[model samples]
Target: MANQSELDDHYTRMDKIFRLSLGEKGAYSCARFDGDFSMTTEAAQLKKYQFIEEGCKIKKGTKMLDIGCGWGHFVDYLTKKGVDAHGVVLAKGQADACIKNGLKVKHMDSKLITPETFGKFDAVTAMGSPEHLCSVEQYREGKQEMIYNTYFKQVADLLPIGGRYYCQSMVFGPKMVKFEDIKFGQTDLWKKEFTDEELMDIICEVFPGSWLPYGKEGLINPASKYFKVVSVDSGRLDYIETIHRWTAAFTAFNLQKYLLFASFVPDYLFDKTFRRWMRRFKIQANLHVFTREIFEHYRIVFEKVSD
Candidate 1:
């Protein structure tokens, strides 16, 4: 699983820009456009969150735990809807921002959460977090499935038999390159031409300490020990649109964002690692994988069915 520092390498690096573009409570996950890419980014994100709300049967006064809550947007939304929502975030910048906004968020690992720590939530949601449940090292050591099983078990323990858990994650697609073929950091960033295998490396640099499941089935099978799958759907196309919109937001003219960008100029110019990291964003390797189906997205609702 991605340690706190690894997760922050991505989330915290973009904290200021994300806040400036999406506001203090904006979401960072894929939005649900349902094949209609015309909707504004904000609208689409809210739509996706509402879908999770309905799918989980959340209502006013419903107690919920938002696992890996980024920026506390969904938690804030639930609070506004009268739901008693608490969030657990691993990233320091994210937790600080949430608390600054008076949100009920704890900067702690969700895997450590138990009934004793939080009592029990009426529902649980892990959006875009499970993808980080198994690190590359764990996957290589053949511990991926075990890591996944542990995640499902933790979530299962946090809910009742009928409780719902919503999860959204990315999985490898048919076109995924062989893991061995991925030259994770050998390729020069300035190279104008590259192969899919090399692109996978850039993607790794973009999201280190993380590895994905094979597909929706990879997630479902591990979860089968503790929950029954209630619903599952592909959000690949929606994620493509979401990425496009995000690119627009990040590149759009904003005084705050410009200031943030300016602050990074010194490091970007002198720090090779930081410069490389910043360049990784320009490759849009994530968008590449999704567009080519090298990675698939899934949204699911699982009902607790076992201990």
Candidate 2:
């Protein structure tokens, strides 16, 4: 698992690139496009927030906390809907952006949050955050479930018995390849997923110290002790669609911005560790869905039952 500082640094380095490619809203998670394949990314994002609000039964005047809130997009949405929404993140870049946008966000670690640190809330959300909570090493060391249990307990502590918690995470799929066994110029994964192992190594460089859960069970079982799993939705296809849109966004960005990005291309090519992951990003989204099936995206809603 990434410590707070490492997570902050990763976001700091990638914030500008993210904003340039992901649009002004800066959503860094899978957008829900249940059936409307032609829906715009922004529209899909709205649908996702709506689903979360409805799924968690959030309404006007409800108190909510958005953990790992990126750029406060959802926080901004919830606030505009008359909900008392607060956000927490470890990324300085994101925190600054949130504050600049006049949002109620704190630059702090979500893991350290407790009732004492950030009062009780009617609901809590953690979109795209749980994937970073446990590392592959942690899972191998037999600490994944314990880590999740502790996290769920903390969330439960912040909510009343009937309060809700929403989470979206990436988990290792049924066909997940062993971390050590993954190779570039693949034999079975995909033909063009990566040109070489250096590109594969860049993924670690990009998301250093982060790892996803084995599967949804890795989350549900631990949370079962504190909350009831009310709903589970597989967003794998939606994520593929979302990434497709993101790639288009990157392509459609103004020429001036593209030129600016191009200036860094040489740097990426020269430094083996710079941005080799960019090449992987080209096919990774679709590859993960169609070929490798190594990762799965899920949205789950939970309600506090007992501590």
Best by lDDT: 1
Cα lDDT of model 1 by residue, 106-208, tens digit: 9999888989998988899988988888888888999998898888888999999989999999999889889998876798987776688888888888889
Cα lDDT of all candidates, in order? 0.90, 0.78
lDDT of 2 by residue, 134-231 (tens): 76467668787788888999999999998999999887777666666645233332345443333334344445566667788978888998899899
Q: lDDT value for candidate 2?
A: 0.78
Best by TM-score: 1
On a 0 to 1 TM-score scale, where does candidate 2 land against the true structure? Answer: 0.88
Residue 279, model 1, lDDT = 80
lDDT of 2 at 130: 83
The CA lDDT at 253 in model 1 is 96
